[model samples]
Target: MTTNIDIIKSSGEKVKFSLKKLSASLRKSGADEQTINEIIEKVKEELYNGISTKEIYNRAFALLKKKGGYLASKYKLKKAIYELGPTGYPFERFISAILKYSGYDTQVGEIMQGECVRHEIDVVAEKNGETTLIECKFHTEQGRNCNVKIPLYIASRFKDVKAHWDSKQHETKLEAGWVVTNTRFTKDAIQYGNCIGLYLLSWDYPKDNGLRNRIDRLGLYPITVSTLLTNREKQFLLSRDVVLCRDLIDDLFFLDHLGISETRKSKIQNEIAMLCKH
Candidate 1:
């Protein structure tokens, strides 16, 4: 492999490619070292100056998918999150599912009265007497990021809603506001979120505790991560408010409703079980 060949990131930044990073990601997918080496070699053969990281990923993913089952599903985590949307609604529901599994009683798209106006919070999570208002900034494009103005605007809305919330309370206190995005946040966004005591969770933020980390740690992968499902099947599950793999496991009736064959049903169930076991 030519070390001098540069690659373009989704952010449009160009940098020399790192075989180490690529290898590490594949290893995280539980791919055997030999398969990873083979994929790396094939990917390297396709590389050229200014190749988008997205293309590199697609090549690697296609190779992995040929191995079939949960391997491809696990490797496609980032892309799977993107498939959760064409709209932010499914992403919000996905986030809500994550928070719910994390032991927070969660609601999606709940309206609350602010000091001056009403706000439809993307997610309202309450746990251990602390209530947090969350807004999900979902983007279908991998190259897009949540910029500083996002948090700037969200923080202002938080203040208004918190003002109203603080005036009266039952059990939970309006403790903090959070902004979560599927993609990365700009450095300024991260800094501002910290400055205002607002929590920001993105793909890889908060040190080792970003949104991706949370999902990996808790095994609450979105239904979009299923390698065994078609786009139509995935969209159908999302429409039924079945976002998490865990949700699908519990609501097996949806499988019957979709007329999934018993053989395919068992395989899907097994793949999900293996994924959660990660």
Candidate 2:
């Protein structure tokens, strides 16, 4: 089995190789190959020995984003990944996975009522016939603040629930709402969520053990094997490396090939191992 460090080195090499190939192709097409090559070299020089392939791509994309025109494709791919999901599941997968793991049946990417317009709910989890609307936030460390979105989601859910109630004759209604994030929510966001009866679920790395332990205790199983595999397939298409992408694709095809359950823990271990191997 390949070690994590090896994987990282290999992936970095592949990124350099791919950039060289792309530069040469662009040169042949009469594009500004020299500038592209310089950009690639600059990015490579700045990259550390153990940087993951994704980080390298992000750096290149950021550089391209600063430039104009055709380079926009590179930036678009990065933006797509950031906005879509870590694994290309539309960011909503995080919300859906948490709900599923918590034993709630969920519908992802659905539109719900706001005050006057329809806004998309990342995930809607139903348990014992009560529905909880969820919104997912996948942001960087600086973007972890959830105060604005939290209040907006709560207000939207209130409108949606009220509309649903008005449409029906039944009196008993569903319970609360939820906002899930890949980063920790602000203290005020958490307190406000509680005040409005909206459950907040955040998932970061093990560094935030308090929150992680609490979520684990909740025993949420929102992500299914099928959903994970689907996400893997989508992400693979956006990958620049054929070999590493194929490896990930194959791994998804036979998830138990490493003899681990297809749960969040196993997936995290596999991803970490893969990144480290690079």
Candidate 3:
């Protein structure tokens, strides 16, 4: 019987092969074929001899992430792997890489003291004299349920912070707190987050349009990956096929740190439609 680990490992291997094929296809699309090859080769050369195939795919995907003009292709690769089932480790790693690329000085998997006991925050990022803690959740479906544990966990940790950390005389204080989920947050959770000044992020949100803008404003990445990817499981709805196309529209509306109204949603959707046609 192949365990989930076995499947994950096999899928990683397949991703390596798929990347090579993708590189070749890029040649026909007027990509810098030689540069692409060199990049892929360097990635392969750095891999351990017995590294799981999923890891190889991750390594190559990470390389492509650094390369420009390949966002759609990257998404395709991600979707394919996700369809193979949850490769939690690789998925978490992918998110971590993206976060680091954005600029946070990140740490993963450490025990943080919560209001009750020591709880772990998946990723903790500190940069430019501010600290931001992130809790990440990966779910394959939507509407299943948002985990209540995250807010509680964050509340506990935030409560643990010394009052001096936010003193009036202090030059810097924690700027924001985030809970990043692969799926959308529930209405209650979103309201709670807003009430407490905690921000929520989801992978389904557009990078160019939504989260990227926030990250840019906040200057949040270039953080290390190990400081993220905590072991917490929650279930939520998978992205509907339509959701993929709506990414830009949804992002433009939702990215407004203020709030989005139904009228604004319609306007943004129109704008997105026009942009997509162009």
Candidate 4:
């Protein structure tokens, strides 16, 4: 029983709100149908023409938090990742960590020599004797998408690396060139990646292998998603390169470095323990 509600996106474009789309996202986060319906009904009541999607998202998230805290936090994963950086370097480290959890040996900010020029790779991951050169495209803004020209540029860099390696008699070979981003890719970017066989992992691209899917599969959420911490606290942790929830768990003393009270640190510790549980 939803109306034809149009909402404004972060990009300032207007589009009709789709309940089916909202429900699908909720379902992916493991929300029961009853809870999903309830959230939808509540969000519908607040909808209006030119309503921002962030407003809708916030309303739905608040309802979901009341219904299920974990699911609500999980829904915040992408935005939490947006909090990971004022730059892309931390995101490159974050991606390296994700790859490591998936059984790949990873290194960040590695410079690989090319025939014509030296290329610096954001991440270099190896698994089952295959190596992937990853170029991380990160966006601090929510609505920006990686475009076709990015892949075109990455493809050129991959050629230089390949050409450099081809001239050598080395044991390691290039398995793939990947452009991983915290946001989505444009239609042309996906098509270009498919046509060229270069890998692309954006927020929700490539079916079940997108960045979100991979993160969900492993439950390797970043520390930025914690409900126990404020936005300023999260940014402080990110500044120290403490991006993952597990990082705090591994070193509880890191919380003390934040100049917060012991009680707050304990709350954060408990929340991290719950959010990062297997």
Best by lDDT: 1
lDDT of 4 by residue, 6-26 (tens): 788887888889988889888
lDDT of candidate 3 over 185-269, digit per residue (tens):
6667767777777777753343443443333233222111111111121111121111222244435432243244668545544
Off by over 4 Å in 1: none
Q: Which candidate would rank higher by TM-score, 1 or 3?
A: 1
- A best-first ranking of the candidates according to their lDDT comes to 1, 4, 2, 3
Worst 10 residues of 4 by lDDT: 66-75
- Candidate 4 or 3, higher TM-score: 4
Candidate 4 Cα errors over 4 Å, as ranges: 66-68, 259-262
RMSD of each: 1.3, 15.5, 18.0, 2.0
Q: Which segments of model 2 are wrong by more than 4 Å?
A: 1-89, 113-115, 141-143, 169-172, 204-211, 214-234, 237-278
Tens-digit lDDT track for model 1 on 202-262? 9998878987789889888898988898999999989988889988776789999999999
Off by over 4 Å in 3: 1-88, 142-153, 161-172, 204-278
What lDDT does each candidate get? 0.90, 0.49, 0.47, 0.85
How many clashing residue pairs, candidate 4?
0
